[model samples]
Target: LFKPVGLGYASMVIVFFCNTYYIMVLAWGFYYLIKSFSSTLPWSDCDNEWNTPSCIEIFRHQDCKNASFANVTVGDRNMTLLNISSGLDEPGHMNWELMLCLMAVWVLVYFCVWKGVKSTGKIVYFTATFPYVVLIILLVRGVTLPGAYDGIMYYIKPDWSKLEEVWIDAGTQIFFSYAIGLGALTALGSYNRFNNDCYKDAFVLALINSGTSFFAGFVVFSILGFMAAEQGVDISQVAESGPGLAFIAYPKAVSLMPVAPLWAALFFFMLLLLGLDSQFVGVEGFVTGILDLFPSRYYHRYKREIAVAICCLLCFIIDLSMVTQGGMYVFQLFDYYSASGMTLLWQAFWECIVVAWVYGADRFMDDVARMIGYRPFPWMKWCWSFITPCVCLGIFLFHLVNYKPLTYNNVYVYPWWGEVIGWCLALSSMLCIPVSLLYKLFRGAAPVHHAPTPDLQTPRRGPADPRAPPPTTEAAHFVRG
Candidate 1:
């Protein structure tokens, strides 16, 4: 919608809202860590008597505390994990303390990136690397636990029956994990010097990213295995994804380990650092996009620090909704719909088409050669032209055919209207490309020629190159053409 002026601000606004939930969840982790210091272990405080007769009959456990079974109804209709109520509900209530922590995170993010890349660059040196240190420490500790091997095995073991779902999940994860549909990669690349070897960097970073993800799986599942052992339940019973894994399951596990407070603090702090790095990059992408579109004069007059602050403030305000009692529902909705794989697939397909077809693959290669002193291999061109688009299109079609309604914890299926709203969110980014193409086609009265200019003739060795070129009609025609 803001294409006439620039798409930078629009990109920033979209990213801001999308990442706000990440910030909120990170804050929730912090809240749990801090709360752990004062209260009894989150798992150990369950009531002696079962609140529901069904729960008593099913599990036959004296108390709900320290149990792997999460569906046991405790008080009212609420289910308990480690005696903590699973606050997974529609229009769920707000958490004031967590809201305050989220605001603090916003403030911290603003201060960290307010000065722009210089500040963020330095911050990333620590934020980016510190998580690995913590992860290693946790991994070392996690593997030492009795049931850790079981957890690791479960994480790596493939269920052949679920191969189709696995492929879909893997594809979606690869796309997001590499940060591909989001313009963050593009925005980050824009900062590189013209001569930077982007092709080389791409492979290195991709490998490192994939490796980190693989490493994290062991750390996470190993810990969950220990938790399952402690609770005397199956690893599958204790396993959860997303917020449940970070806030409820992991924290409960940490509470069981020796030096619980220290480990809990370190774990949450690692989460904070990891989340901060992502937020920093996200904000940088937004800011860089705007600055790239606008002239330097305008940027100088407005000031980047102020621009960043405004972005942060707007994000903070908008995210307040997600911090409300019912905010998890809102957050889940955003996660389910916004920046979804379908939207990403659509974006990637069109981007490949544009660069490989509309923009001309040969021209793109020439441009790359000019910048990096060597062109990418021929296979890359083929990949861009055919393989990429076909894969993206195939995945998108497959997803549409196997479309599943959004659900929370296998309950609370989104209403059809809600699903429609989700589709709108997903399509918002995908629609921009076709809309812009149509707008350009209809708005223009004349076709624009985009043929490359021919290389200029070298000047005569001695001097007076103009005189030499003026002699021949062919030369003149070539020069003019």
Candidate 2:
């Protein structure tokens, strides 16, 4: 129960709540999966075929021109949802009860983190691997569908003109998907065995992650295409929706299938597992970073639980805005400012600075080489040093040029002060880097130990290796534990 310092324990406060929300959504994904197997499931009553060129049909169809027709039938409720009138109904307010429910969700997340990373680390083992399993299942099913190829073409068939538009999205997706630059990479990098092959591990992780996203498109689009074929509608109509793609779009597809409910349930459940690992690991980074930067801040005390409790309370309150349909608004704002384009740009820039500029490139490369038994290629060094910074800087400016404030109810906008408030909020955890450096400058560097920072960096240690290869003396230069 160690207490954090400062008048406001800002970063901790943000992580506690934000991470909680993220995991809750992930849990919903899991819940959906479980519901799929049951006869009594969401949107299960309808037996109507989903759409014309079914998702599977579209995925499998390479010609993109023709498809075998599936008999068309549409369910009652599904039709009602798509009706024009359904779109106009406005509660125009937030749901207090759900907000309170969110509080409970946050509390559950906090309890898991009570024991810190040691406890949290165990949970990631299951959460991280399950999504891949689900993806494989979906991929197998999708590829067999007649129209899946058409759906996949829609995903990777980039309009080069739209590349600039999608560049931010693609970059943002990479950033959020991998949780890069949000201090997670930096802190995690610190934990690596000094000479662990980080580059290889990174490549492998990328391979797996990107492969999942790409393959997932096949499954998702195949189903969509299947629905399209069943409904006699075009694929464009299906792709136009938002999260509705999950809630409305996919459920409709299931209803048309032989065992619709079961598939829906499994798909959602898989989402939960993926999200659970993502949120917990994110929170862990925040927790580890705080402890690393300010050892005395939360020294033994009852403050840890207190911090957790406070986060739960605030999350529900802020999230209560969801009742008004503003919940999505609030989420979108936080998602954009806290974890979106701005955040990634900040991360990419800062990380490069920390390792390349502040710490020095040769030293950083030396550590990377030791961990994996090879140094970064010349191109990598150039990217880490010169190219990355410029790219990030340019992109970050684009974020500013396109800056739009988040509104409370699509009317009253968050003030400029609110943007300041948001940035200060996100930057709180990183205060340690500069503060620690200042302390060293004034008091003289402390003796090296297991830590990977300046006082400790004779060479090696930090940024936990997910799973890497054999190492020698270079491992000591980066990390061993």
Candidate 3:
């Protein structure tokens, strides 16, 4: 839809749309945190409606007059648990209060990252590290529960029959977790000093990310085990994924623990921090990309705070759809379609092709060597030129062959038009490369040139020229040549 306008604008639109969803998710974490404090056991029962018999029974002894639980009705019967639905959909109304919370989150994010790296960098020291502390706390508590071992066993014990599926899922998870094709990493790295050892940084970050994922599995399963034991159900019965895991099952488990309110608050607060960290980087990338497109003089004078505000405002307005009664439906659509495996694989494949073929891998290595004072191993070049592209292409083709229609809660099948819209969303990111290339070709644009360094411009004295005069200075060489 944005093709005719320009690639830069299209990129901005994509970034804005994606960031709005991040904002919505961050708001969700805050909503749960606020709810955690209002009630001693907010997730004791899925149904929050005070008029309901279950709600009355659950809260009769406690102060049941709290306004937070007053008018909330159980909605959307797709993922029913304990006689309550996901509360994501309510036939024909918008969740105006949730919308307000979402707006508030956008405002918070604006201030957190408005100063760009200077502010966000400091914030990351906490936002990034605090999750581990919370996770460890939860892990300790989880393992101490009666049936926590069962949950951990269930999590680690693999089914050999599902090996192929496991490999595919693992690859997809790693790619997304590392934010490979989202352009955030690239934008963040651009701020680093030219001679920084990005090679070392990449490995360290990857290890940290993968390690956290591993540790989190133990924490999640241990709590899930406890839930299963308490309910007299199998671990499989209590296990859930995505929003079901975060918003429903996990909260339910936390409410059963001692000092439930405190645990819930800590857990939800950790979630909020993690979401904020992700949003900080995403918004930073969006702002950086826009500034790079505009004049450098304007960027210097106006700086990023104004751009940050405008982006936040626009994203807040766009994200209102998610706060509606059908907002979760829209959120699911965006989640399944945008930043999907297919799109990421497509982007990765093209990135490999561009750097390894079009831009010349050998030349890239030369630049890297100049910056880092040592050349990368030959294996990296081979991976860039061949292995990475092949793997990406293979995974992408595999996904196509095994494509399934999008669904919600494994029950609500999206309509044909909804699936079409999803395909369009997936294609939006994939088409940027080819569409922009075609546009440039049609406009007769020339490839960008990188001027040679002064050292490179000066010719080295050769053994064949032993009788020749001393090598000329760089300035004299440039003047003469």
lDDT of 2 by residue, 200-270 (tens): 77777788788877777777888777666555566665553334566556766656665566567667767
Candidate 1, 211-260: lDDT as tens digits: 99899999999988887666566788777775667765676677677777
Q: How does candidate 3 score on lDDT?
A: 0.68
lDDT of 3 by residue, 95-212 (tens): 6667777878888888887766766666677788889899999898889988899999999999899998888777776777887767766666666555556776677778887888
Residue 14 miss distance in model 2 (angstroms): 7.7
Residue 436 CA error for candidate 2 (Å)? 12
Misplaced by over 4 Å in model 3 are: 1-14, 50-91, 297-300, 445-481
**2 or 3, greater by lDDT:** 3
If ranked by lDDT, best first, what sequence of candidates would result? 3, 1, 2
TM-score-best of 1 and 2: 1
Q: Which regions of candidate 2 deviate over 4 angstroms?
A: 1-21, 27-108, 144-146, 188-195, 240-242, 293-298, 301-317, 323-325, 370-374, 402-481
Clashes of each: 5, 79, 0
What's the lDDT for all of these models? 0.66, 0.55, 0.68
TM-score of each: 0.83, 0.70, 0.83
Give the lowest summed-lDDT range of ten residues in model 2.
80-89
